[model samples]
Target: MKKSILFASALLASSMLFADSLKLEGTIAQIYDNNKTLLIDSIYGGQMAIKVLPNTEIEMDDCGIFGTDKDGTFKDLKVGNFLE
Candidate 1:
């Protein structure tokens, strides 16, 4: 029983480490034709895009080159902007 409990705990901890959180930020490299998706250049130096849900809020910071704007959209978020 003790061994089983230890194993379970270890597995849980390892799983948590590998879990992916969905806080994405990046430049809008390309907007899909449907407009529901866009290609983003992630701050981590990878290109990826995710579908946006209805009524979702996109926020950004207020400083830096691509800082967040008053409308929650980042400033100068063109094809070569950095996002976090």
Candidate 2:
């Protein structure tokens, strides 16, 4: 049998290393499209499984030399991408 771990976004707040509304920096380790969840490997030496809810606000930043910033959707997320 396979066991799946679910990480609720709310837990970040009460984490010993995190404060309320703390921003997380990490790389996208895995993407579960069917459930709209992402497994992230944090630079802080931790992993997080975040589920994307329907009302969750999403955004992508423009770090390219000449790219413009724009709104983003879950479909735009990819493995190996760095996020903050």
Candidate 3:
């Protein structure tokens, strides 16, 4: 099946310790619900597996396309969705 890709504006996360967080933009190549992880084909030129913790925050912020931001759950994550 063909996969869909989504993009969003840059994300800036701040921590109390002022540490810089690693940011990546990528396409969701695969989803592993059993492990709560995603296999991402990164635009940076490689594939990475990211584990989504229970505390992970998921949001759909496509104001330009969807008109508003929506809180998202793990079930909302599908193969091919762009993540950053």
Question: TM-score for each prediction?
Answer: 0.45, 0.68, 0.70
Tens digits of lDDT, candidate 1, 21-71: 657777778766566666888877788986755665665446877775554
Candidate 2 lDDT by residue in tens digits, 1-84: 122223444454458555555788899999999999999999999999989998877788897997777888999999998988
Highest lDDT against the true fold, candidate: 2
Clash number for every model?
A: 1, 0, 0
Candidate rank order under TM-score: 3, 2, 1
Alpha-carbon local distance difference test for all models: 0.67, 0.84, 0.82
Q: Which regions of candidate 3 deviate over 4 angstroms?
A: 1-20, 64-66
Q: Which is better, 2 or 3, measured by lDDT?
A: 2
Relative to the true structure, candidate 2 reaches a TM of: 0.68
Residue 34 C-alpha lDDT in model 3: 97
RMSD per candidate (Å) reads: 6.0, 9.1, 14.6
What C-alpha root-mean-square deviation, in Å, does candidate 3 show against the real structure? Answer: 14.6
